[model samples]
Target: MTNWLPSLENGTGPLYIRIADEAESAIKSGTLPHGTKLPPQRDLAYDVGVTIGTISRAYALLRERGLVTGEVGRGTYVQGNSDGRVPARDPVTINYGGTRAMVPPPGKLRFDTTAAIDVGQAETVGRIMAEIASAYPGEISSYTRTLSSDWLEAGRQWLSSGNWKPEADQVLPQLGVHAGINAVVAAVSGAGDRIVCEHLTYSQVSRSANLMGRQIALVDSDQNGILPEDFERVCAREHPKAAFIMSSGQNPTLVTLPLSRRKEIVDIARKYNVWLIEDYLYGGMIDDRIPLLAELAPDRTFLLNGLSKSVAAGVRGGWVACPPHMSQRVRVTQKMVSGGLPFLLAELSARLVLSGAAGEIRSKVLTEIGEREALVRQLFAGKEFRSHPRLPFFWLKLPEPWLSGTFKQAVLDADVLIDDEDEFKPARSARVYHHVRVGFSEGRERAISTEGLKTIRRILDQSPLGTSAIV
Candidate 1:
């Protein structure tokens, strides 16, 4: 059942439609039986000569046809159960971070997200929330009209680097880094404007841009970061209005864009008049030693940082430090797009940073991340991998015969969830790095993380040969 593949022989309209047609026919003919786990997209893509994106599009078509359920983060399956029970979904308007796991299903080991190591911030957060509600009942009940100076101070402090610190007036507190990023996109670019991004990057930026009717223009990159020449080529060709870069501890790749490359990119952007969105979610947490992109090119950079990566994920605390004279515009855009920030969330986040409670929790979270990273080092010692000292995840290049999606599926079958390279792909299957990101922080329990790593190690040692792992 794990080796199930749709026959792409002869009949076709669009390739994705053809694959979906095959899947639908198979489903109706009972050839693809209920509960049969399909082959991973990358695996089938290689088998039938297609990009992983093509396979993904086909799977999406199947899902649209109500033939499959689940997603990239959660393993996909045909929509039927052996026990005769239908899955209950809330069917709400939720922006599912398909690459990052939200609350994982029971019994699945979560190795997919780097959304903060929970070091018990709930007690502090809850206490602060209660105090705010009691002290200002009227304020708590009303729409937030003010951006407190305290919020700006906290944002500036957290976003400040070695040689660069923004004035308090330049900072605008946002709902979180993702929201902050989108706000910047909204501010600088219009519908149909091109947004340049690294070929392999945090997909949320590109995804958000696409949702806003902006086109994604992917630039080629190396192990270090985006290649300057390619970026320039993209800038000249695509004529992008904005560009998003992680700069440090970049999502799945864990590469820190060097200062030289930063300067080159800034020059290119300047020449092209492309606004820069510097998402520093993990950058500040990993190392504040390096000078930020905003420091290098404050004229064009919109720096974003938040509490989600360091202190607590549920807090929804984030900020945007815009270029001079641009904070108010981005702030207004954030309000327009995000329906304005919740008063309680804004106040609590500001209090957490100003009160030093967020720092305290951040330290504990960092310590936990270091410990988990150490565990990753010990277990994946001999593997072909790339990771930062403080990053919660590592990029693993698979061996011969093991495609990224195939290994990801094998690992999921063993109850562990990690991101296939496809999850972070900037474009389509035109480029396949044959890598997967394995995160330890989301596993929660150290023992669970240990077991998950062991399972991953076992699968890595055993070539799939088109069959799933026995575990």
Candidate 2:
């Protein structure tokens, strides 16, 4: 280890913050290069004449900033040289009339986003919104901190389509699932607190945790979804402030947690008194038979559901069913961040649900997604990929000799876009897996999606030497 000591003289703010700032400066200046081992916490504390707790807090802050990584017995080390910024991946381009265009150039086949395909929903929503605007002209122009009674009832009715049911008063309208998740995390957890998630999960949750200054502790998961044993282990070790899980058709992996596993997770959450953030983002796409984490742990669960995945992304309407006691706190937090949900969007969403347009659109979209999934399955019959017939994405485990970045680049070179595993991984997790999430929902036409799948297969079938390496 290098004999390095951060200058604490003339420090202004908290001592721990000053320590973290100095460490960040050292890292950026190359004084503490990547992979350089940091001194033991106790030794640094003794040298700085501060308590060990202060040093520990400073290190925790650094870890959250992605400036350092810690091992069980090996201590902490600097992570990267770019001051915690993950360098952007090279854009995939295509040659067009003596010019090169990005993979997702105008009208190109896009398979990277998990957005819902249009199933005649846009016209329906537009009609409903038009009707709503005509009927409630004054309401559309005004701001509403609290959802109207009719809108609340609509939210309750929409939630009834799932396994859990909550009263309108317990539901808070959010801009979307992302906004709801950020508000809930901000309300329930604090900076430096640990948040638990599946080893392979949604990227939005990871981003929300990072933005809120929380550390993510990833738990192991199997085919049946997140393992209860691993959840218990993480809870006991990290004492996470909350656990965010997508119980149905988990993102990327598409593994739904069976009822038995849900019960075990609920039991563990109860035992540890950890809050549960149940993400039902893909719940509407699948059947409603599976048990929900919110149903199992209602007292501590925040049920997140929205119309973005089932209806159209433009809707941007969602709700967070909070515990009866915490409803007001969540509402206050949401108001503090975003004045409130857009009255017009909420009214439009409510009209869609109340008028049965949302249900009709969801059914049509699910049918289309099912057909696409069948095509994908037949196209990659023997490939090692995880998918649900109704889900929007496929988790393709890359074959040997092809790492995640390499495979992603190859697919991009062939004019297709896909998300690599690193996008979904939590910071500080030591686990590494080579996989890509191929989404079929972005392409409304089956032929376009089929073409994208064919392009991916062609790349996958190529030899390592045939594909150019990403410099």
Candidate 3:
């Protein structure tokens, strides 16, 4: 009976909560049927390697929820068949041409790949709104209005403080990174122009480039990130109009280009006269955040950043700081796409930034990062995986025996869902070396996710040596 329960070590969250969640799952799944007796607390605790007091607390939680009942000396039993009040499990309906399946609601140990923003960020947004409405109303009442110059100045100051050093006129606010990328790509790289990028890059950027009808040539990269020599070689051959690079905390791979390597890439871009678009999505989280490539070559770089990564996604707010010469191009494109940034949200976000609450939010964010990274380190202690302390995800390069697809399927079978390497490939004949990208942004209390990790580890342990293809 205890074997059905997952091991909770190497995961974030407390022991009793995990046990209670597992017990609730058992009851809902009909494994612990109505009136079926639960194992004695002491016995179950010993089996699962938790204190008996923890087991008692877990059973008490179930009893409080009316899922279980206990009789003194006789033991506890399932109360009823989940009382029918439980919400129906409507699997997340994703219509991806009907080929892919719906994602299941995360269980205890599910490895998440999707970005998750919780109510904390949402509440911050709400507070921002209230501040805007109380302080400056009538502007957001459904009429088209340009953003206030004051808030724009604040944004400009914000960038200057960070050393990006752009004038208020040079800073252009927009909806989000996608819009920012789309506008920049369209303005600099016309239709049919070529853009060069890392072989494995952000899928969103790739999609955005495709939408603009520009061809993207993916250059092979090394472990340190896009190789400087390869980047220079590609620039010489492809003659791309722009190079889209995530200079800090790249997704999927969880690798940040070191300063020396960054300089090499920036120098290559400068030499080739290719526009550099730096996506600073994970900008605020890093310590000693490097100066944007825009600073390195102010004449040829465009910086895109937004609240999507640091704050809530629905903030629908982003700002672009382009080189002074490119200001008119960016402004013209901005007028075509929603005119200027929304004033209410922009003012509110700026308020949050000015009040120093944003710094506090970031501190809390760091605390969460510490918790998640600790869990990742413990879980993948001896496993072949790559991570950074502030990264929201980890890049796990699977062993030789496990193909990327097989590892994905095996882990999915165990109820964990992760992103495969294929999605990031610019072009591919199937996927090469097997890799699974796992996100830790879902917060603690993810025992089901941890369970999925354990299951994958178990599968890999049994897999034949050298079964997977090497890079």
Candidate 4:
């Protein structure tokens, strides 16, 4: 390895990222090769005039990017090139039924593994929560005067990040996404109202509609997401009150609608005068180039964005961005059925999000996600797995002999749980891609879990289908 010291002209941002960036550039330039040993954190800190904490954090960044690996006794070694692309680790084949959680128990893991990782903004969350906890109890507990403008301004600023600016008068804060969905449904539709849905819409949306006694009109989807013409036809025939569409990185499908498709959907909604309930939960993680459905169809659209996807799902914070005409009624519904979100949670989340930690966490998450995808692709070498570049998960199509149920069972025996496609749909033989959603949300360790992937491969190879393991 080349003798190099990364110097920060200004101690701005995190010192560790600057170090990682320099090391990454060096690796890309061939100054460091595969299998080169990196200096110890203390040594690097001494060399670069940074704190040991900074060096440690820098190494963590490298680990998340799949550029290096650390063994218990052995020091860290370069795993691959600086760009973070690396071959999967050697498969440690096992007899199966022995997958263990990659994350260490509470005392060992640096980050929380038990809770669903907010992925992005975790560090920021820690800081904000710390600040909140140290404050006087009255700050968080005592009743505070309520007003709509503050929440509306917050929503407007958030929407502007995606080049959207819904009128402040149209925005309202709900307890959470579920509450917003329930309130919106209650406000828009009565019993027997029909709502158009994507064929692979989120299960919660379906359940919520059912609870409201509304009919769901399922529309077909092609590669780009829900088909435009099918949506138009469904609207024409059903004249649905509102279409609950996810135009951003959709949950199960993990598909993001391109600008052209968004235009098509918007035009159709406009022509039919149909209300649109846009679920933009997967908003902050993916590409921000494409504007949201609300931007295109603001006159008749109600947007739902919550902490559930981008932030801590359990923390329960979400806001409703409505069109001007619906703001009053939406606020009424929000108050009558469910009132404002807890000020403590809302304010904490807002502080974290607005402080730019949310965006930082998002970038970090995407970086980790890329590393996890590399491992997944390496493990499923010969299988026909598919994914979008920025998506959190992949769609794995099963082989002929591996019936979805049987394969799910096989993996379960291997101590790995996988979702069955049929459970996401009703018609068992409808031939809807018999697939499983493999998410990288399990964090870095699970993404690169040697034992877990080997078990996954064994399950794939032993299926009744005539398939052989690669390598």
- Among the numbered candidates, top lDDT falls to 1
Each candidate structure's TM-score, on Cα atoms with residue i matched to residue i, is 0.85, 0.77, 0.71, 0.68
How much does candidate 4 score in TM-score?
0.68
Task: Report the lDDT tens digits of candidate 4 across residue range 1-471.
Answer: 346677687445556667887777666666767888888766777888875545765765566456777763466788874454554433231111112234443432221121234454556677788787687377567654464355666665555534556777777766777788778887888789888777665555655666567877778887679889999999899988888877866756677788898889999999988888888766555646678788777788888876655456666667778877787787777766665456676676566556776556656666666666687788889998776555556677777655554455446444565555543431112344656655555544653444566666777777432221100
Query: Worst lDDT window (10 residues) for model 2?
Result: 91-100
Give model 1 RMSD, 1 decimal: 5.2
lDDT of 1 by residue, 1-471 (tens): 467676777684557667888887777667776676788766788988986656766775566455677554446677756753333333221222453446666799888878888777788999999999998899887898988888889888888887678889999888899888888999998999998888788887787877788888988888889899999999989999989899998888888898899999999989989888998888988874777888889999999889988888888899888889898898889988899988888888889988999889989888888888888888888889987766778899998767776677678767888888868865554566789999888745788778999889888988664344211
Ranking of all predicted structures according to TM-score, beginning with the best and ending with the worst: 1, 2, 3, 4
Sliding window of 10 residues with minimal summed lDDT for model 3: 91-100
lDDT, candidates in the order shown: 0.80, 0.78, 0.66, 0.65
In terms of lDDT, which candidate is stronger, 1 or 4? 1
Ranking by lDDT: 1, 2, 3, 4
Q: CA RMSD for every model?
A: 5.2, 11.6, 13.5, 20.6
Q: Candidate 2, residues 221-296: lDDT per residue as tens digits?
A: 9888888998999999999999999888888788888899999999999999899998888875775567677777
The clash number for model 3 is 12
Give one clash count per candidate, in the order shown.
0, 0, 12, 3
- Candidate 4 at residue 252, lDDT? 65
lDDT of 2 at 371: 93
Which runs of model 3 end up more than 4 angstroms from their true locations? 1-110, 114-119, 157-164, 335-340, 429-431, 443-471
